[model samples]
Target: MRLKVIIPVVLISLSAGVLAFTKLGLSDDPPGRYEVIMNLVGQMLKEGHYQPKPIDDAFSKEAFNKYLRSLDVEKKFFLKSDIDRLAPLSTHIDDELKGAQLDCFRNINTIIKQRVAEASAIYPAILSQPFDFTKEESVVLDVDKVEFPADSVARYEAWRKMLKYRTLEKLTDLQETRDKSREDSVKNKTDQQLEAEARDKVKKVYDRYFERIKNRQDDNDRFSLYVNAITTTMDPHTDYFPPDEKRQFEEQMAGKFFGIGAGLKEEDGKIKVLSIITGSPSWKEGHLKVNDVIQKVAQGDKEAVDITGYPVEDAVKLIRGNKGTTVKLTVKSVDGTVKVISIVRDEIIQEETFAKSAVINGTHKIGYIYLPEFYSDFNDRNGARCAADVAKEVAKLKAEKVEGIILDLRFNGGGSLPEVVEMAGLFIPEGPVVQVRSRGGDAIVLRDRDKSVQYDGPLAIMVNEYSASASEILAAAMQDYKRAVIIGSQQTFGKGTVQRLFSLDDFYPVKDGQSLGALKLTQQKFYRANGGSTQLKGVSSDIVLPDPYYEVSERKDSDALAWDEIPKSNYEIWSNPVNTDNLKKNSEKRMANSAAFKLLNENLATLKKLEKQESYSLNLATYKAEQKVNTAALKRYDAVNDKVKELNITSMKVDLDKIGSDTTKIARNKDWLKARTKDIYLDEAVNVMNDLIAQTLPKMQRKQQ
Candidate 1:
């Protein structure tokens, strides 16, 4: 199944590097900022990257093609003629990196601008006319499955089919709503009127889509994309972060930001609210709600800017500013009422991204900890960190007298390396956590140093294909020590590389307050304590689950680094190990008898089958038939856990006391507890915890306690 899970791969990065760009830094002639950054990044990747690929003709060709795809991934903007026009300069990118003029990027950028303008007119004209639903045609949604349009006529046909498909989608949804709604106005509409309305809506959506593309995506944004295409050709994780993007990445790593606390998404060309953070400005203001369409954003008394077709990131930039500053939003509610709301932005702590604990009570009381990421804030000495937060959670769970503990690292993308080492030490005795190797340098083992074990009871870690970098390191360490039973997908996301951000200004200083962005370069590789790299081969689970994201992984990316091995670090296994064989057999038997799991396995197969069938029919009747079958199949397995019996779970008394009388926090905590009530994975994890308690208990207490 293609789940489309967007998660960070690996982020164990150092902020600074050795002064290796001395010659490139102090050149007499300081070039433009873009050229300076390009040369600086090239030198850093070549000299500082853990395993640098040769910057030669072959690499240039790949980077050239990658940049083209990045510009028009859908193959809609560029034609066969455009690719042919740019073909001659494809192998000259390396020359540009080696002090030549950047002709390739300049030419490609110019052509894309022209094509984007051309395609803008194409979509509106196509949507103006009525489509014949009687025409039976199929469109391949996957870009790799189709080639660029041969000429302008073919391009127009492509746009027609695409617009028709979009119109059909809206028409079907409108039909479904009319059939289900009780209101007389919607229920009485005829098919012909509905089709026209759908076409109009599609046209409006494309109008805004093109408007944003034509206006907001500037030359700098396109340049960043080109830089990323080059860096990612070296490895998927390495990237070029412009200043604002770098700040956003740091905020994500810290699990907080200064904003109105509303999560936004671009839907039908409108910026809509997805969620609101608890105890933040929007939550306190209480006007902004889910699905509210934000039309304009103003800074206090300043004139408002129309943000109707603004991308989510652009809207966010307009909304968020210095703390205590007022940002006004003009919102359109779902009921069609429009109102202007003003809110003073503040520090929004995303507690949802932090470590939280819940007690799962069945035959035994088990503590569950969900760590969204390996978050850390090095900038603030007193800032919240995952290691300290998880330690606090563990202490609370201990006070609750839970029998066993389960650590869920399912979607943790990873953060600071040192923090993960300390977090891993909380489980096992002082030992090696992970190994790191620089370019042509000996492997260095990062050790915990502490001899104390915080939790010696039965332990288990939950992982999936999205458990990457630091998550893999922790899981691999615990598994190597035989401390925790790894359970979830077949293996975790295999991102075993370390990266560091190098500020371009450090390498090439420019005058007049010019700011050059930073490069997040891959500087090292990660290995488990057992010496096997986690690069392409991630840590395997002791008990595998029927995961729906089987196809989403690092291995799928052609540019991912290769897996290798190093000498095993000196360490000792846990003196007491969990009997994984018994746990595996027990889990297998439980799954074998589960009807939910049976349905899940069947649904997975169906999803796999549907995922392979990429082409979709545009004819109304045929499309409806296909969607009806597919939708029903998915509906049967969607939220499968909701069908299972709810497991008894609750928050600790200390947590309740800490959250006392804060209505929003209290309600959010309750919702958090309620969400996991019927989680199939957690349900079985609770069962495994019960079995472990039974297996480890003393002879007398086995039956009594």
Candidate 2:
């Protein structure tokens, strides 16, 4: 894959009040494993990293601050006094690294252990007391806006407020549920009883939470986190993975996992769903979404288990199971409502994560190919490759005599750089597709040497904010050649840097059963053949469209590499360039007049306004009123999805053989085709192709003939 950005999912489960771990007593000396890894990491950064910063006191301070944040992101554990005590060693970390000592880490680890033990006592005491929800107060949920407590008394007071807020949140939820239903059972319960129940529920969640934190983490995990702090200081994309983390990273990149098929992360001390893998059982079930917090997990016919405090890895173990078994998740939505979702454990092969084609019935037959990622099986020569699969799909479309083609790359976060070059060649006469420049090396153009143009017809490439890396390269190349009209989001995700993974064991051999993990280091930057880099500034779309995801872009990422241009690569422009200026003007006019687009814009505006909110009330009245307003506003946008357009999408005949025997595949394909009819972006892409055929392609084809 070309610069595969690995997002590690950390989920762990705990048994009651205990977490499984091997704790090391604090010592002034660094552990043998840590000493070896740290020294090697420093060497690797200096030699292997493309943009290595000076390993001076400034870098040391950055790493120190980063490590502290990782240890306690929500400012709930360490107090201001603890921070003050640790402050003196901030610049000394550079000296420590150079001398192969870790006095600072040893002291910080000891302090954290004491604080965790103290926190274990503090949470239950606070939760056991009755919470007065009627109190007029607000808790600053934004961690960056708040400071650490001054001392033990102040820390407990902060804990009290946080615990009260949690209880208040649950109390409001319970009261609202009763108000909504007015059921016989719910109506019988007194407000006091309901309030007490909510408090108990919050306590149970925290009880398990504190227990897991006290137990699940080992010295290795802590050491790994410290190493990552150092690595990530180089850049946001660069990361150090512990052995287990490396295994998980490989599993995800392989496009399959024997689990519930949900990506997870620890956010604000809760396990939040990062994403539901496409074709996974959880995705098929459709109850989960990004940002939803998983509060509890239960096996089939077993008592529900609280997992709120569990480490992400431990929680993930509880979620993963033998195929066909059922795991139930109690998921809290983004808006605070909670529900139970059950998904059967299954092997997620990720077959659907590759390229898939369907024929869209329009005035002119149009073939639509959806590439989720530029995937490839590097180990197996005959294994699946996205470019090869796309070529096969195009050949199938050619056999069907399709008049035009649309490549849908929305939310495709890129993979396999070589595969992208091959895929780009399929649409145009082969030439320089992209330029790669490594540190201390000359810029080399990655070319598609073959002169064959496979699908040189009316074409449109659809993208969104999540389209990135290899996605940017392919789109930028096609745009540069004027071979196709790029449509959809304002710009694609601007990740143009390349990364190479190095196994830590390769540098230094470890003892049997011990692992040092892997490091993903940025090694190069990619530029378009026309000389423009798609780094921070992504490939701009020809026909811009309103998208809820417009807020997401590389510009928001503070650590992203800057945009710069290199010398233009030698390449010929397309013989028949597209009329993008005319096409864009027509699309803008249509978007202005279209009702669906209008509603989409309104929805995006509301979403963006909501995104600005940083504080929330602990008072039930104010919270509910605000939530109601947001809910009502969201309901107005439901029409955006309900409004269907003219799209007669059908599965390819070639896919029939693949889906004939598998009912799951058939059902998935059916759902996919149904969703396309309601997709405004796809609707616009099809229209763009129609416009191309009517206004642009005819003249170009005549000239070529």
Highest lDDT against the true fold, candidate: 1
Can you give the lDDT of residue 398 in candidate 2? 91
Q: What's the lDDT for all of these models?
A: 0.85, 0.80
Query: Model 1: which ten-residue window has the lowest total lDDT?
Result: 1-10
**TM-score winner among the candidates?**
1
lDDT of 2 by residue, 446-549 (tens): 89988888888888899999999999999999999988889988888898887766676765556665877888777778899999999988989999887778
Q: RMSD of model 2, in Å? A: 9.3
- Judge candidate 2 at residue 688 and give its lDDT: 81
User: For residues 1-705, could you state the per-residue lDDT of candidate 1 as single tens digits?
Assistant: 011112222223334344354423444564667777777677667766778899998999999999988888888889999999899899887777666778898999999999999999898888777888888798888888989999989988888888899999999999999999999999999998899999999999888888898667788989999889899999998899887777677778888788899989998789999888767899899999999999999999999999878889989878977789999999999999999999998998777889999888778889999999998876687998999999999998998899899999988888888889999989888889999988777888899999998888888899999999999999999999888899998989999998776666665555676667778888888799999998888999998888888877899999999999999998998877777899999999989999888888889899999989988999999999999999998997885775678988888888899898987788888898888898888788788878878887763355466
Name the 10 consecutive residues with the lowest summed lDDT in model 2: 10-19
| Candidate 1 Cα errors over 4 Å, as ranges | 1-29, 260-268, 272-305, 322-346, 510-514, 698-705
CA lDDT of 640 in candidate 1? Answer: 78
Question: Could you tell me the lDDT of residue 402 within candidate 2?
Answer: 93
Candidate 1 whole-model C-alpha lDDT, 0 to 1: 0.85
